[model samples]
Target chain A: MSAIAAGVTGNNPALNIGIFAVFVAITLVVVFRASRNTKTAADYYAAGRAFTGPQNGIAISGDYLSAASFLGIAGAIALNGYDGFLYSIGFLVAWLVALLLVAELLRNTGKYTMGDVLAFRMRQRPVRAAAATSTLVVSFFYLLAQMAGAGGLVALLLGITNKTGQAVVIAAVGLIMIVYVLVGGMKGTTWVQIIKAALLITGALAMTIWVLAKFGFNLSSLLGGAVDAGGKTGEALLSPGKQYGATGTSKLDFLSLGLALVLGTAGLPHILMRFYTVPTAKEARRSVVWAIWLIGIFYLFTLVLGYGAGAIVGPEAIRAAPGKANSAAPLLAQALGGPVLLGLIAAVAFATILAVVAGLTITASASFAHDIYANIIKKDKLADKNAEVRVARITAVVIGIVAIVGGIVANGQNVAFLVALAFAVAASANLPTILYSLFWKRFNTSGALWSTYGGLVASIVLIVFSPAVSGKPATASTPSMIQGVDFHWFPLENPGIVSIPLAFFLGWLGTVLSKERRADKYAEMEVRALTGAGAEKATPH
Target chain B: MSTSHDPGTRPDPDEPDWAEVHGSAEFVELRRRLRRFVFPMTAVFLVWYLVYVLLADYAHGFMATKLVGDINVGLVLGLLQFVSTFVITSLYVRYADRKLDPLATSIRERVEGGAAK
Candidate 1:
């Protein structure tokens, strides 16, 4: 990295630059070829639902395992030890929510977006309107987060802090992501995710094996070595609350964050969208099982990477920069595999961000074009396949531009928090609406609308006033209100504990109060959701 | 191709409407069998996972209690979380294969106006 940073890479940069170019080049080629196959709206939106369970399963994991999991978790472990592992564990367990409740039923029910499922039984216009708002809110925030993180990651790799260089990096990434969805559609996106997932798993495994072998294949000793590496703060390193605790608000914060982590994936538009790419409910069921195995296998390595970084890289070296902890795994890569392997990891992380953002863009486009524009605004426009595809492609460009601009503007913001906020909002707003629609008989259009809008608004309003948004430092001499405005009253960083239940309550209350008792709606949904008897079929190729 | 098939809104004529399917013995049995596994599994996992989280948060020393050299109670519970997810998933898949799949097939056949089970 220093060699690259100093413009003195000579040989190492070639390997790094070569790998990056080849990966991007291959992706571009794949999209170009896929563009030919993307003839219909179903083809564009869901790859004609052609994916096998294992294929889509691998793609789902690829859609997951963001730079946060690859980079941030390792850093947390390096800096905070056992506490860092909690974030990864929470993420892993969250899949239970997806696997058991969301994935297969979602595959059976929806065509394009979450709104498709929610609006399946409810009054279409109002329910779709609410779903569209939440979808955009989650996707845009998540896109901005990934894009901003892209700029920083690129800047770190190039070892240049120049604003122009960072902006250029962000633009390049944004453009590539836009091209991916617009040209190749879901086929292009899924292939990218598969390749990226393979690379990620391979990279993580190689690094982990190297770490374990270095410790003579003894696991506990590696952990012990980590414990002793701390000169005075060794005990703190082994404890549970280093990251979430010590602030006197640890328990509430931990639970709220946990709630968001567990329930958030069920609501994410992109992850939910993966279901529509598979062919059958059986495959959907099998896909989650495959995803479970792959993700579980990966998390084992993540644990090794974390502890290995803590032992090899040391906390002091990791904490050298304000948010430099994310560099822990990369630094460990350099230590273990030299600049060559480090380059590989960097390219893979770039791929991770790219694939994730591509998924986000496609899902957002689908929602805007299908739900808001086609269904709501242009409802009476006689069905035109060409028009819907065109609208979606146009929406993709607009969303891409917005995300790029947001990414560039929010460059200095803490992207990690942005992602957490997205999760919190997803859990609070989208999850309740989905659950009620799928499960509850009394669940009316009013309940769905109230939960979606109420959860979205409630989460955002609470976050705006929360200390995490703009933290207030005590003492006037310390810093002014700019550090954080003093009016911030919300206690927890995550709104899941508060907003999630409130959304559920709002849904229930609205249902009970409303005169619309849609037992027929529930009856119909139950049959379809359970048996896939009358559900949308994969387009016959 | 772009426009979604509005299938669920108006049930097709050949297949019995959802109300009939809902009342069918096969459908009732299917629901019961699914609930037998899912309800218990969901409750147990949620309760157990929450306990681990609460203990970690509220009971620090208990979590940090070292059962083996350099290993602790917290570590054991963490490892179990992974173990339990696999156990539940494997169990569900097996149960579904043995129990739910055949029942769903029967329910579908009946809903399509097949011979009564």
Candidate 2:
């Protein structure tokens, strides 16, 4: 599945790297200015809850649509045809699940992280510990996936073949993300995301327009071009069996992947974190409305970009190198308007990666400093707002270092697969607990703790044993066998089919079997979650 | 700002009385109306999406059935996913405003008024 791209003109990709550098500088300047306003934990964690529905909406879209969607899915569609479009549909629909069932309710019930909601009706310490544990688990997998994929992606696209050079590039990315979280916090990060989201949309739109305009704005001709370029395999490209659905396990694999995508978006810690940036439930709901439309339009553009790249760039050229699929958009830009357009896209991609990494870092740090260290460890230190803020910043530095190391270790993995693993964990572990906390009348401390922990453990164990981690070719696309070991058991690539149900069942079982009941507080939490009665108010920084 | 000052904090007494709000008919009505939208909609969307996934996986001929020129059933079906999402969003917003919002407002007003005393 790794396309060893042929004919890389190898003429100094420094132009692309140079563009990435400019983006980093602009982000730093904004972060520096924003730092002055982030003296409190509220500013550090939730952006002082000042973002309007539209602004937060844009930021949410930025956070949700990472390199995986922008680059990975485009590459998939370019290579696999119809199945690639399936990924986009799954991602877009997941937002609706979030907008309808989770968003406003989450905003009304919780104040900071998803952990806030999990601990809302349960015993504070254990429930929070479980929540923080799951949050870190979800974020780390997601962060590692983003960091690792972006590292390889930058190095390859810039044509930086040196290992040391790649390491340096990744290190710089890690350091800058730390700065964004440390200096700008949530407020600074939001602005960076807004700018990046706009750039990404413009870049994708330009490519789609350029491609479609080539074929007289006719989508069928675009499909025809793809077929013509592909020769005999071209017609097969229009269908699904070429990428998936060929093997007997394909149906199960598709089902697992579907469940993860639809259920996972609602559970993602970073995406859920965005709901808290707005003050009211109404604003929270409105922001989701903006996100779905914005995100929907973006996915449609990817469909055009993906097929256009296949038709124009050709599959042979893309497969000439492993991971040339990731370079589809950039290569398309180069094809359309030469180096200038390519540079613009490459820079936007760099900014997109930075914004997402910064968002993940802040959320992870908040889980550590606010939920675990500040809340659970030093329960009495709650009044020391300055100290909590300080610890959160320090935690950001630590998380940044860990992400860099993990990225290096996970280098060369497929960006999209890594993202799927993260989603599976979120959907399986974090989601059931959040739903039960807000909705179920009998949910107790034991049930919350059991479900959270059970889901996390089940996801990790199943993934490790799944064919995805133990297949073959060892590339991001191939079924990977871990270090040539292949101790495989699970058949499905995604763990959602098994783990999601297991997590929910464990929560229910724990509740039914437990001696202690929480009925007294359940109605109160339900009221707060539903009506925003006595919900936490946003403060000015 | 509820737990900003103290980590692992309990509900602040300065806030509204939760038991009163929980018992209110408006709060009950809000939960019911919201569920009416969420529960059914979630089930329907999941089925609609899984049908797409299953057809793509099992019935490739159907998905690839060319309809009107070069366009296929698969392409139209895939695009419909986006359309359905927007329709659901618009519907939810209208429903929330018409049914959920008023009940929520009444509950909030009653709680705030009682807390003010």
What is the C-alpha local distance difference test score of each model? 0.80, 0.82
The i-RMS of every model, in angstroms, reads 2.6, 1.9
Give me the chain B TM-score of candidate 1.
0.82
What is residue A281's positional error in candidate 2, in angstroms? 1.1
lDDT of 2 by residue, B1-117 (tens): 233344344446555667667776767677788898899998889899999888888899998899966789999999999999999999989999999898888888777676655
Model 1: DockQ score: 0.43
Writing each residue's lDDT as its tens digit, candidate 1 over B37-75 gives 776887887787788777777777887888777777877
Clashes of each: 0, 18
Question: In terms of lDDT, which candidate is strongest?
Answer: 2
The C-alpha TM-scores of every prediction are 0.94, 0.96
Best candidate, TM-score: 2
The per-candidate TM-score of the B chain, in the order shown, comes to: 0.82, 0.84
